[model samples]
Target: MMKLDPTNLHRIDEGPPSKLQRLIRRSRRRRPSTDATSRMAARLASAGVFAAEAPTSSGGPALLDGVRAGGATLRRLAFGVGGGALALVALGAAWSAWQERPADRMSDAVVAPTTADRTGPSALGTTAAVDSAAVPQPLSTIVPVVSVDELPSTRPGLVATSSTRTEVRSSSPPAPRRSESEFAIIKRAQDAVLSSPAQALDLAEQHARAFPTGELVQEREVVAVEALARLGRKAEAKSRANALLTRYPRTPYVVRLERALGEPLSPAPSTSGR
Candidate 1:
């Protein structure tokens, strides 16, 4: 058992209370102890220099982000590039289409050489504008091609001569065989058929000699038959018409040949003569 002192009961000890003043820290600005200075400092390990730059920041901000951020940037760039390429492709296609169009080609009509010289970009623009503004003409009215000599002379002294003859020739155009078209030979014959039947027959004979089985063989036969009838050779015309009808049962030349001969190639369906 511990005994209590009679004097300590009144007081814990003999010492009075001391004042609690704030004590300034001695090592705030001072160097550490001798033992601490002697010991090795906590330092980062020397990294192996694989490249000039480290994974983390060196002195400045880090450039290439890790996989996720880099991939995101790359994706954005790829999308942008792809979009640009698509735009370029569409633009190029449109340009090619515009260039290939036949309507964009210069008109076949002979444009009289303009008095003013057209040299610059402005000339192209002006020409396009004029073409756009010009009203379209029908194929029959619109001359496809004309030479300078064939066109009427606007110059004072140059007289427009009647000798400037124009010729247009047609046939049921099949595939052309030669450079000199079958139309050329038949055209002359067709024109002369009305006025000069003898001449037309001569031309037809020429055509037969040149193109034995021509594309315009039907037209040639029709012309020959007409010429024969016009020249007062009914027997020859009838014989030729019969032969032609036999060869081509549905020959379109029947109407013209029948009219010229003033009779049917095949005998007319005999009416009810009862």
Candidate 2:
């Protein structure tokens, strides 16, 4: 309650604030400005660092380009494989078709008849007896049948008496010495050997049944035997040779057949009169 001098009291009341007091006052005033500054800094960082890079080109073209390149490569590979497979299939089918075709169809006309020569007697031999009708006219003209005594003894087994003229002893003409079809097949098969030995073998086998007792049967057997030997089928060649010897002992090819059988034929003696 003691009254001090007025000037001294005023100086004491107006004295400078302490450091801790200045800090409290300054914090209160700077709160809004600090918040605004923080917001500005956050906006700048987001714009510079977080924004997405501008696209150089749309992704559609890049994706489409990759797809196109892959598709082109795949298409090329598929086409190559498909074309090659198709070619192989086509070639196989063509070869099969060729193998199935008849040998005669592939041969020339003149050669076809020669192949027929290997087939035995015709149906006419079985049905009709030899007479003037069966006798070949040219041979009969050259050697008239005035009597049976004029006929050659070496004539083949088919002969018949004429009903019209009993005294005229005419014989049936010889059956064609060969089959037209068989000859054609054989000729073609022989020609085929020049190109394909395997095909020739197939043809020979197919035609063997038709010429069982033909004049050329022995020759055909020889051809078959040779073909088998050339193919390195020694067993088959030997078997064929044995069959030929058994069936046609008088075959001219007996020497070759015997040789193929591993037993060489003895040489024919000199025919000169000593």
User: Cα RMSD to native, each candidate?
Assistant: 44.6, 48.9
Q: After superposition on all CA atoms, how large is the RMSD of candidate 2?
A: 48.9
Best by lDDT: 1
What lDDT does the true structure give each of the candidates?
0.44, 0.41
What candidate 1 gets wrong by more than 4 Å, as runs, is 1-106, 109-179, 267-274
> Residue 139: error of model 2 in Å?
30
Candidate number achieving the greatest TM-score relative to the actual structure: 1
Scored against the true structure, residue 155 in model 1 reaches a CA lDDT of 55
Q: Give the TM-score of candidate 2.
A: 0.30
Clash pairs, candidate 1, are none
Per-residue lDDT tens digits of candidate 1, residues 96-155?
Answer: 332344342223111211311132112112233223213232335444444564465675
